[model samples]
Target: MKYIFLLLATIAGMLQLHAATVDTINVRSAQMNKDIKAVVISPENKKATSTLYLLHGYSGNYASWIKTAPHIEQLVDTYGYLVVCPDGGFNSWYWDTPKNNYLYESYITKELIPFIEQQYQVGSDRINRAITGLSMGGHGALYLAFRNQDLFAFAGSTSGGVDIRPFPDNWGMKTHLGEYHQEPKTWDAHTVIELTHLVKPKSLELFIDCGTEDFFFEVNNKLHEKLTYMNIAHHYLTMPGKHNGEYWARSIDFQMAFFAQCFQKVTLN
Candidate 1:
């Protein structure tokens, strides 16, 4: 009994020692003129040289990922990559809106990325960086990654609102892009489904998945079809789940594994 107790204690201590460290950081966004809060998960050994920018859904903030999927901390330890969860702002849709103070597009690509690279031990190259999110963030991830292929080598979305034109009345997106009826052109330009043209062959690696029961399933499927039509290489998946935290909690594992494989390829070459 004494020896068994000692072994169990040793195992617990080892787990505690190697656990990832989670920090709440304030990144100042010059475009939005605010100090945005983000959850930064760092590996215990500080040996990670890559970073993953994870995003949240509509009305969710920086803490959303940490709160929804606590296992992400273990993921950091398992993958040995830093994870950053930035606040996209409520209903911002991660856009540099022509209407409101939601200049998130500029903030993320310009301010957030630079700040994280300088502050963390992460590499600045596209191969060492990836971006992904859930729902609104899913759209935001693909939108930003497609536009800035120089910044991210891997991009993914889980239950993303890829085509906002279908549900303009929802999510308060009108406050950012104006009503869909009035500014059809603007809506067409921002939606991820429309931006498939921007992606060049082999320019970026893509992973997209959604639950069949999710309301965003049709849009995600359409985006997948469109990407296939364009001959853009990607990984698309459909699993048994919904569009809630439970779904994302399960989906993030696959996405992280995908990114890890991509990162390894860079290291091998």
Candidate 2:
């Protein structure tokens, strides 16, 4: 009995040791003058070559991705990369507010990326970095990457409010960008669809998808059409699902695969 117990314990210990580890880290942001919480998932292999920054949707914190899509840890292990899920604040839209002090745009691009590269053993180049998110975060991932092409090599969005100008009353956009009635131009300028012209051809690899029944499906389709019109290459898909966990959980798998392919291509080059 004693020997059997010892063998079982050894196997359990080995399984635990081989599993990916999740760490909650507080990253300080001088721009926001606050310590943001981020969930870092490190694969069993310590020598991770790349990093993926996952942002959460509105009303979500650092734990959103792991809670909704727990299989991301498995992706970290299979892809052999570090995954960083940062808190973008509830309804911050990952934007730098002009009226408020929510400078999340600067916090992410300026502070968070630098902190991650310094703290982790991941590569520190555009080709080694990727970003993606769902809903508001989906918008944010594209917004940030489109503006800062030098930082992220690939970007994706799942059911993103990509065109915020359409829904001014929802998601506290009026508070973040001023009342739509009062600031129509501001709303237009901040939208991801409006900013597609900023992307240079083949400068950034992109993936966008949304559920057919999602409220944002029409907007996503419009954004896709606009991108196609502008000749910006991207992978877009419309699947049968809603704007809930069931959709996002399955959608992330596709996005991760897309990023994995991008990472592989970069490595081969």
Candidate 3:
């Protein structure tokens, strides 16, 4: 009897996955020949407080988050909010650079956000929009949000390669910056940790989470320390996991819930 009950329970759980549907969108940018893919998930039964603009990591397409974090449906199945997962390219680092053809910053700020606002039930205010990502996309999320405060109110990064100067010669970033030695300023200016100096801190809510066992943990820790030195208030979290889908999928839930809560409206007379 117990054996039969366990088998039935496992079957029911697998069947539940069919209930949620992911709507994918592909947008081509004139800034680059490449096409951007995004997955938009909205719940119809309950009204949600805000929208979560998600970005993908290096070598990851927009499908990464949706495929890894299947539990996203349960988190807000009743709360009618928007979840958007946008591609940051194989590894563009979400930069609008002096040399690169892809101006992802412009595409997201000028094109994608407008499309979302125009096509969906999105609020125009910055408070209603939040951005976050992992690894390369984590760098992108902070870089975009910090540079364009008017577009995003809350920002978070998970295991972001925050300081890129160390890898100036490694990643294809040299092509984007035209050699680090030749354009040191560009490299310094674009790094997420280096760019932190430009942030106003209090103007936007921020969160950063990284696994102590992750390769990028040192840089992420440096970012947390620097932000603290600057007297910036942010949610800094450390967990015991590596750079993988299992951790990221779990982390996004907390990020989404926190960002959604920030966008909730309140009034007092």
Candidate 4:
């Protein structure tokens, strides 16, 4: 009985040693002129040197990812990578609004990335940086990665509103791009589907997945077709689920695995 008790205690200690650590941090964004809240998760052993930025969806905050999908903490432990979850602000669509003070695009690409690099011991180059998100964040990830290839080498989207022009009145997008009928050209320039031309062949790695039942399913499919027509290489998947925490939780597993493979390839080359 004594030996068994000692063994059980040893196992518990080992598990505790390998658990992931979570921190709630505030990163200053000069573009937005305010400190943004973010959740940073680091592996217990601190072996992972790469970083992955995870963005939340509409009506969600910085804590949404971990709160909705707690398994992400375990994922960090399994994959050994630092994960940073930043608040994109409700309905910000991760864009620098022309009519509003929401400069989320600048906050993410210019401010948040530099803050993460400075605060964490992760790689500073694009090869070591990746970004992905659910819903609205999904569009933001691809938009930022496609336009700023020098900052992120890998980008993924799960059930993302890739094309905002389709739903101008929904998700407060009209506030950012103005009325679609009033400024049709501005809407076209901002939509990810229209920005497919910005993506050069083999310029960056991409992963995209959406549920057949998701409201954004049609748009995701359209974006995939556009990428294919543009001759851009990307991994796209469709599964049986809707646009909710259940689907995103499962989808994130595959995305992190894909990112791990990309990181390995970068290290090998």
Alpha-carbon runs more than 4 Å astray in model 2: 1-18
lDDT of 4 at 258: 80
TM-score of each: 0.93, 0.92, 0.87, 0.92
What tens digits encode model 3's per-residue C-alpha lDDT throughout 1-269?
23323433453344333334468988767667667778888765544446778888888988888888877765545334688888777768899863657688888888888877776767767877889999898899999988999888889998888888877776688877778888988788889888777788477888889988888899999999999999888888888889999889867756765664565532110
lDDT of 1 by residue, 1-269 (tens): 23323433453334444569999999887767779999999988757889999999998999999888898887777667899999998888888874587789899999999999999857989899999999999999999999999899999999999999999799998877888999999999999999999997899988898999999999999999989888999989899889899999888877877777778788889
How do the residues 130-195 of candidate 4 rate in per-residue lDDT, one tens digit apiece?
999999999989988888888888999999999887787898888787899999998988778888
Model 4 TM-score?
0.92
- The residue-by-residue lDDT of candidate 2 on 123-237, one tens digit each, is 9999999999999999999999999999998999999999998788998889878888899898988899999988987899998999999999999999999999999998898
Superposition TM-score, candidate 1 onto the true structure: 0.93
Cα lDDT of all candidates, in order? Answer: 0.87, 0.88, 0.77, 0.85
Winner by lDDT between candidate 4 and candidate 2: 2
- TM-score of predicted model 2? 0.92
Backbone atom clashes (below 3 Å) for every candidate: 0, 0, 2, 0
Q: List the pairs of residues colliding in candidate 2.
A: none
